[model samples]
Target: MIHAYRFYIDGEWVEPCVPKTLEVIDPSTEQPAGTIALGSAADVERAVTAARRAFAFFSRTSKAERIDLLKRIVAILKRRNDELGDIISREMGAPLAMARAEQAGIGATHFEQTIKALETFAFDYMQGSTRILREPIGTIGMITPWNWPINQIACKVAPALATGCTMVLKPSEIAPFNAVIFAEIMDEAGVPKGVFNLVQGDGLTVGVELAGHPDVDMVSFTGSTRAGIAVAQAAAPTVKRVHQELGGKSPNIILRSADFSAAVTAGVRRCFGNSGQTCTAPTRMLVPVERMEQASSIAASEAAVLVVGPPSDPRTDLGPVASSAQFDKIQTLIERGIAEGAELIAGGLGRPPHLDAGYYVRPTVFARVTNQMTIAREEIFGPVLSIIGYQSEDEAIAIANDTPYGLAAYIQGDPEEARALAGRLRAGSVRLNSAAWDSAAPFGGYKQSGNGREYGKFGLHEFTEVKGIVGFLND
Candidate 1:
C-alpha cells in the first residue's frame, strides 16, 4: 500500500504539524488502497505563508516565462499519463479505459490549452486612452472535489500558474493520490519554490483555515453547493474573491424533432458515465409527454446493457460509486423515487445481481417523474436518471429552468432547432445533438450552480485582477 504522510509545502514534502493520518479507500474493492496525512490549521498557515512569499515574485513573472513552465508540465504529464490513469481508476473507481482517455487526458488538455491561451491572450489593453492592466490576483486557496480530482486540479492550477499566481491547494481527501502525483509533476517541471503547495485534509480544519486565511487573496472551490456556501462564509471576514463551481441537477431536453431512440439512449450512457459522479451531469431528462413511454424504454434498455464491475476491467462501463456512503445515498434516493410514485424502469435499490463485494450500484432510470420529486430536484451524483414529461416546447423550457441550478443543459434535435432551443435554456453550458465538450469554451453556472468560469482564457482570468490606469495615459 502507498503511504503518503508528508504534505507538499514551499516546493518540498514535509511532515504535517500534527502527525495524524487517514486511510484512502479503493471504492471498487472496498479496501485500503493507501494512506495520507491529515493536515491541520498549522499546515495551512505554513502553506499560505509560502504562497504569499512567492506571490511577490511569481505574480510579476513574464507571460513568456509562465508559458514555458506550463509547456514543461504538459510534457511531463504526457510521459506519466498511464501511471496517472491507473492511480485515478484505483482511487476513484473510474473504469480503466475512461481513466486513461477522459480522466487523465483532460488533465494534460487543460495545461496545453492554457499554454495556447497564454500565447495570444492580451494581458493589457487600451480603452479610451486609459491603460487597462490585468495582473495576477495574488495567493489563491483552492479546494477541489474528488469526483473529477485531477481535472479540477489541473483546471485550477494551470490557470493560476499561467497567470502567475501562487496557490495552496487542498484536494479531496477521498481521492488525493492523483493530486499527489500532480504535485510531483509540478516539481519535476521546475516550478519555482513556494509557487504551488498542497495540504491534504478534510474541510473542517484545513479547508476552513485556507478559506479564512487573511493572507489569501482568492478562494476557488468546486464541490456541493452546501460546501461552497461554507467556503464563502469562511472567506467572508477577509473579503477574498471566492470562485465556486458547485452542484447541478442538469437537464437533457429531447425535442420532438430529434431521433427519439438515439437521443434517449445517448442520454442514459452520458448520465451513467463515471457512475454519474460529475457535477454537471444531465440527470433530469425531459421528453414530450406522449413519447415518455418510448423514451423511458430506450433509457432502460441502454442502462440494462451497461457493464457494472470493477473499474480495472476494460469492458466495465459502469463501476462502483466512489464510496459506501455514496452507494447508500443513491440507494436511498432510488427508494424515495419509488415511494414518490415514479416508475422504476431499469436498476434500483441494491447492488447489481451477483455483485455484493463493492460499492457497486445498479444503473437505475425512473419514468413519469414529476419536477417536485426529490430525485428530479436534487443532485444524486449516481447512475440514476429521472424522465420527466413535458407537454410543449414552452413547458420543456420551463421545467428545465425550474431547478435552482443552471450549470449545464443538453438539447437533442436538428442543428438549427437545437441551437435555437439551447439559447432559451438558463444554463451556462448547453450541448447540441451530443456535441463534443470544448476545452476553450468558458464553463460555470448562471445561478446557484455557482459563479466564475473555468477553461481556456476564462479560467486564466479567474486568477487575475483588473486595474485601469487612467492618469498614466493622459488624454
Candidate 2:
C-alpha cells in the first residue's frame, strides 16, 4: 500500500499547515489508489525557506562532492526500480513493463546522464584575458506533470543538484506516489536537509506561490501550454527566470520516397505510445494526398493490433489515460472530428468493448483531416491520430508547420532528403526514420511549445548563471 499523507520538507516528513487531502485515483480501475497531504501558501513558504537556507552551503559544494551525492542517489534509485514501477503504474496507469522500462528507468537514466555531463563540465574558463564564471541560480520551484512524472522530476532535480542549486518540487497531485517514493530515495541517499523537498497541492495555491515566491530564483514547469502561461504570468512580478516545457501537436510526415507501409505503421505506433500522453507525440500525420486511403488502411491495421487493457496484464499495449477528464476530452475530440467531416478511419468515441469501468479510450484515427479542423488544431492529448493529406512535398511541409506548437516532428524518406527536409520544419527536434531517443540531444520545442531546453549538459546550464570578469588574468 502506498501511503503518502505528509510533505517532505527540511529533510523530514512534515504535516501540512492546512490539513487538506486529495485521493489519487488509479485510472485503470477508477478507484482510490492513495491519499496525499495538500499544501497551501504557508506550506510553500516553509519549503522555500528551507531551500533558501540550504542554498547558501549547498551552492558552494565542490563538484566532486556533488558527483558523489549523485552516485549514491543513482544506486538507491536502481535498487528501488521495481517499487517505483509498481507505484507509477498504479498511480498513473502506465503498463507495468512501460512504467518500469520507460517511466521509472528513465529517471535513473537522467541521473546517469547528469553525472557524465558534470564530470567534464567547466564551471569557469578564461575567454582571452577575461575569466568567465558560472554559478548556481539559487532555489528552484519545480512543477511537473502526471504524464511522465519521474522523467520530468529527474531532469529538473538532477541538474539542480549537479549545478549546486536547491529546490522544492510541486509534483502533480494526480500522480504523487512516484514523487513521494523519490523523496524516500533522496533521504536514503543522505541528501542534505532542505536541498530537496516535495510538496503536494493544486496549481492555485502551491503552484502560484512557487511561481510568485520572492525567494525562488527560478521556476521550471512542465504541463499544458495554458498552465505554462499562468506560471509565467505569476513569475513575471518576481522577475524570476522561468523555464517551461509545455504541450505539442507534433507532426509526422511521410515523404513520397519512403515506403508507405513502414512509415505509416511507425507513425501510428508512436502516436499511440504512452496512451498518447506525450507532449512530443506525433499526433498529426502528413501523407501524400493520393495515398491517403492506403496510409489510412495501414494505420488502422496497426491501431487495431494494439491491445488496450488493464495495466497489470503484460500483454496490454495501451492502458487507460491518466484520468476521467482526459477520457472525456478525447471522446469529445473524436466526436468533433466526425462532426467536422474528418474521416473516422478507425477506433472512435468510447472504451474498448472488452473492458469497461476505467478511464480507457479507444486508439482512434481520423483521415482527410485538414489543418484547420478542430481535431487537427487542438492538442487532444490522447490515443487519437489525425492524418492530413498534402499535394506535394512543399505542401507537406506547409501543412506540418501550420500548428502553433512545434515540440517535435518526424520524417521518413530517403536519408539525404529527410535530412534536408528536417531543416525546413519548424520544430525543436526532428527525427529521420524513427531514430532512438538520445539523452544527450537537447529535448524541448519551438514557437509556443515553450522556451528553453532540457536533458544532458543543456539541462545543467539551465540551473546556472554566467558571469564574465574582465582582465582577471592581467599580469
Candidate 3:
C-alpha cells in the first residue's frame, strides 16, 4: 500500500508537526488503500505563516510573471494527468474514464482559463479620475470537498495564483491523493517558495484554524451547509472574506410541451452522472401534474440501466460513493424517502447486486414527491432522484425556488419557452436544453446556497481587494 504522510509546506514535503495518521480507504473495495498524515492547529499555523511570508513578494509580481508561472503549471499538469486520474479513481471512487475526463481535466481547464484571463485582465481602471486599483487580497485559506476534488481546488487555487495571492489549501481527507498530485505539479512548475502550501487534516481542527487565523485574509470553502456555517462563524471574528459554494437541491423543470421521454431520461442520467454526488445535480425533477405517472416511468426505466461498479473498470459508468460515512448517510436518506410516502419508482436502498463490498449505493428514484418530502428537500449527496409534480408554471417556479438552495436549475421545452423559463429561475445558473458550459461566465449560488463567485473574470476578482488612488493621479 502507498503512504502519503507528508504535508507540503514552505515549498517542501515534510512530516506533520503533530504526528497523527489516518487510513485512506478505497470506496470501491472497502479496503485500506493508503495512509496520510492528519495535521493539527499547529500545522495550520506553520502553513499560514509560510503563505503570509510568501505573499509579500509574490503578490507584487507582474501579470506577465503570473502568466508564465501558470503556463508552466499547465504543462506539468498535462504531463501527469494520467497518474492524477489513477489516484483520483482509487481514492474518490469515480470511474477511470470519469476521473480522466472530468476530474484531472479540471486542472488543465483552470490553468488555461486563468492564463487567458490574466492575458486580458485590466488590473487598473479610471472611473471619473478615481484611479481604482485591484491588488492581491493576501494569504488565503482554502478548504475543498471530496466529491469534485479538482474542480473546487482549481477554481480556488487557479484564481489565487493568477491574482498573486498566496494560499494554503486543506483538501478533503477522504480523497486527498489528487491534491497531493496537484501540489507536485505546482512544485514541478517552479512555483516560488512558500507561495502555495497543503495540509492534510479533518475539518474540526485544521479547517477551523485556517478559517479563523488572523493572517488569513480570505477563506474559500466548498462543502456541506453545516461545515460552511462553521467556517463562516470561525471567520466572522477576524472579518475575513468568506467565499463558499455549499449544498444544493437544484431543480430540473420538464414542461408538458417538451419531449417527456428524452427530457426525463436525460435528467435521470445527469443525476447519476457523478454517482449523484454533485452539489448542483438536478436531484429534484419538476414535472406536470397530469404527466406525473409518465415521467415516473421514464425516470425509473432510465435509472435501472445505470452501471455502478469498481472505479477502475472501464465498463463502469458510475462508481461507489466516496466513503463508508457517505454510504451510511445515503442509505438512511433512502429509508427516510420511503417512510415519507414518496413512490419508489426505481432502485432502492443497498448496493447493486454485483457489488458485495465497497461503499456502493443503489441508484434510487422517487416519483410523485411533494416539495415537503424529506428526499425532495434535503441534499442527499447520493445517487437518488425525486420527481415532484406541479400544476402550473408559477407553481413549478415556486417549487424550484422553495428550497434554501439556489445553485442551479434546468428548464426543458422549445427554444423560446425554455429560454423564458430559464430567465425566471432564481438559481445562480440556468441550463436551457443541453447548454454547454461557458468557462468565461461567473459561477456561484444565490440565497443560502453560499456567497461569492468563481470562474472567469469574477474568479480573478475574488482574490483581489479594490483600492482607490484618488489624489495621486495628475489631471
Give lDDT per model, in order: 0.93, 0.94, 0.91
Q: What's the CA RMSD for each of the models?
A: 0.9, 0.8, 1.0
Tell me which residue pairs clash in candidate 1.
none
TM-score of 2: 0.99
lDDT tens digits, residues 240-314, model 2? 999999999999999999988999999999999999999999999999989999999999999999999999999
User: Best to worst by lDDT, what's the order?
Assistant: 2, 1, 3
Q: Give the number of colliding residue pairs in candidate 1.
A: 0
Model 1 C-alpha lDDT per residue in residues 161-185, reported as the tens digit of each score: 9999999999999998998999999
Per-residue alpha-carbon lDDT of candidate 3 for residues 158-252, written as tens digits (9 for 90 to 100): 88999999999999999988999999988989999999999999999999999999999999999999999999999999999999999999999
Candidate 1 regions off by >4 Å? none
Give TM-scores for every candidate, taking all chains together and pairing residue i with residue i: 0.99, 0.99, 0.98
lDDT of 3: 0.91
Steric clashes per prediction? 0, 0, 0
Q: Which candidate has the top score in lDDT?
A: 2
